[model samples]
Target: MDRHSYMSFYNIFDKNLLEKERTRSFVLLNIGDALKNHEIEVYYQPQVDARTGKLCGAEGLARWNSPKAGLMMPGKFIPVLEAANLTYKLDICIIRQIARDFRKCIEEGTPIVPVSFNFSRTDFETCNPYEELQKAVKEYNLEPKMFRVEITESTLMSDPAKIKEQMTLFRKAGYEVLMDDFGSAYSSLATLRDFDFDEIKIDMGFMRNFSDKSKKIIRPMIMLAQSLDVHTLTEGVETAEQLSFLQQAGCERIQGYYFSKPIPYSEFVQKLKTMDCCDDLKDCEK
Candidate 1:
């Protein structure tokens, strides 16, 4: 190709890239509005007990159906929303959805299990997270203990004082607080010390090496949490080998596809019903 043609093509490519970025901003703006209009749905991922293969709990992950985008996951829109300083808005939407689902499960006699949802650093930075959570809970007739909050170490470690207050308020309300993605950052110990975490989720990176590095890290961490009397859940157990490793390592619970993938609320309820029937059948055999 000639130099003139190549230069023209590069210019057009640059303009197209710039236009894409501009379009992303516009899409995010619409997403913000759509969220306010109740356009988001919550997806539940089951956390299973590695020992008994029972459904323990589920994580509350968000999904949005945008008129333009068709369907979207948090990863696609959250960063853009955060960039626009709208994370708190998104957080509230998620919290409300979780409360709604909890109510539904309770009404169905499903023994409301804990649902873990992520909170960013901004959620802690708020001056009144305790009252905010209480208000949200009341709105949906949910008890504080019915849900769990997973805050990253980075959030708590950002401003120790604020996070401490936030944690105290949440505990006061009888909510179980968890340190999510533990050991992924440098601030795990500090966050644990500052807040009385009810659970600790082992980072997936560590779990991936559970078999070969058992004695070195995973086993010790499991033992350490047991000694402290705090529960531990291993994330990303996608294979039987990994599940066996975690079970032998003394981890109490796990969340991954080795049991079942995350599903919509209706589907999850159906699975629970199936589980109940299976349990009844086993009892009959005995």
Candidate 2:
């Protein structure tokens, strides 16, 4: 191509990219407003008991349907909020929404199970996540047993001492703490030794390239958590083979597209009813 033509094309491309970046940054910064307006929604992905294949629990994930931006996934938005130091806003939104769903299910006598959500490092650095969690629980009149607090392995590195103390507070308040993405980062055996985590969540990334070697790695992690007396859950189990191995390896809970994908909690409730898991749900929390 001619130099002048190439230069003209590059300049226009750069300008368009810059404009898009600015627009995204504007939307991300004002996500605080999105929270208040109920524009951010929660999608629940069901967790099944590995032993019985019954609905046991679910995780609450964030979804934003932006009028201007269309559907925003966690990958598209979470980092932007984290960069803006506004992650706590979204954290509290999901926590409260999950609590509200818990209340709605119980009040309607619907078959219910615990819902897990996460706390980013910003939740600790920017605000009192535990206090906000309590406010939401009380506001919705929901029990702590109906919730699990997930923390990624990397988040523990942000402030290990402070997070350890905060996890203690959560435990004392009857909430279960899970080490999310257990093998996704530079895992610290020391972190596991220090924190009183009730569960270890093996990440889905490991399943993407599932092989004999993957089983070699996953089996031992599950065994380690078992030796430590913490429950084990593996996410992203998308096939019968994945489910078979995880179940055989004694993963207590399996969450992935093998059984279901993330959906509205109302739809999950309908699925539970159809599964006839009501009788089993009574004992799932145990």
Candidate 3:
């Protein structure tokens, strides 16, 4: 290629990259505005007992309701937020929403099962998670047990000392700490020993090929958690067969579309009410 032609092509490529960066910056700035104006929302997905199929708890997930873009899933916006260094802000917003919702449920006489929220690695590195959480709980007059914190195994690997300190702080504040996406990382067992997590959630990938061979690995992991007196929960369970296998393998809790998908706050409250009524009726029949 001629020198002038190569220079022209390089200039065009650089201009395109610059334009993309500007677009990303603009979108992230708008997301910050959405957070301030309460366009982002917290949704809950229920978790149930593997043996009894009763409502045990829920996991709090984030959603963005953009007026321009309609509803957006976390996958759509979380990376943008992280890249923009705004995850700590988003995490605080989620915690505040969960606290407010828990308060509202209590006032209306609804059952308040524990709800868990995910914390990014940046959350630990940049902020005082313990004090931030304590302030949120105090603002709502809620107990610590009403909330659980989920940290991914990979996140824990980022800085073991800091993560351990944060985990210790969480437990000291009366919140249960759960290791999420356990098998997805290389050092799952190492974290299990080095940290004081109350529970370990097995990654859902194992269920894709949940044959005897898979069980040979999973069953032992569950048993190891049991041996340490840490509870076990499995996510992404979608069928009776999968649920049955996890149950037989001694998984303590399960969450997935097999029971229900993540729903809005109002629908989740209604479902909880319906489940409570059904349990009452079953007791009457007995």
Best by lDDT: 3
lDDT of each: 0.74, 0.84, 0.84
Error of 2 at 155 (Å): 0.8
Query: Candidate 3's residue-wise lDDT over 1-286, tens digit each?
Result: 7766654333446887786576577567697688889998999999988878788889999998888878878876787767766788999999999999988987787776788999987887778778889999999888888789999987888798888888888998889999999888888888888888899998988876677787788899999999999999999888898888889989999999999999999999987787632232122111
Residue pairs in clash, model 2: none
Candidate 2 lDDT tens digits, 152-256: 878888998889888999999988999998888765467788788999889898898899999999999999999999999998989999988888888999999
Cα deviation of 74, candidate 2, in Å? 1.2
* Candidate 3 collision pairs: none
**Deviation in angstroms for 281 in model 2?**
7.1
Instruction: Candidate 3: list runs displaced more than 4 Å.
Output: 1-23, 277-286
| Candidate 3 accuracy as TM-score | 0.88
TM-score for each model? 0.84, 0.89, 0.88
Quote the lDDT for 34 in model 2.
Answer: 77
lDDT of 1 by residue, 54-154 (tens): 76677988888777767777877776766665667777778888877777766766654577888777655543556667888888777777678887787
Question: For each predicted model, how many residue pairs clash, with residues at least 3 apart or on different chains?
Answer: 0, 0, 0
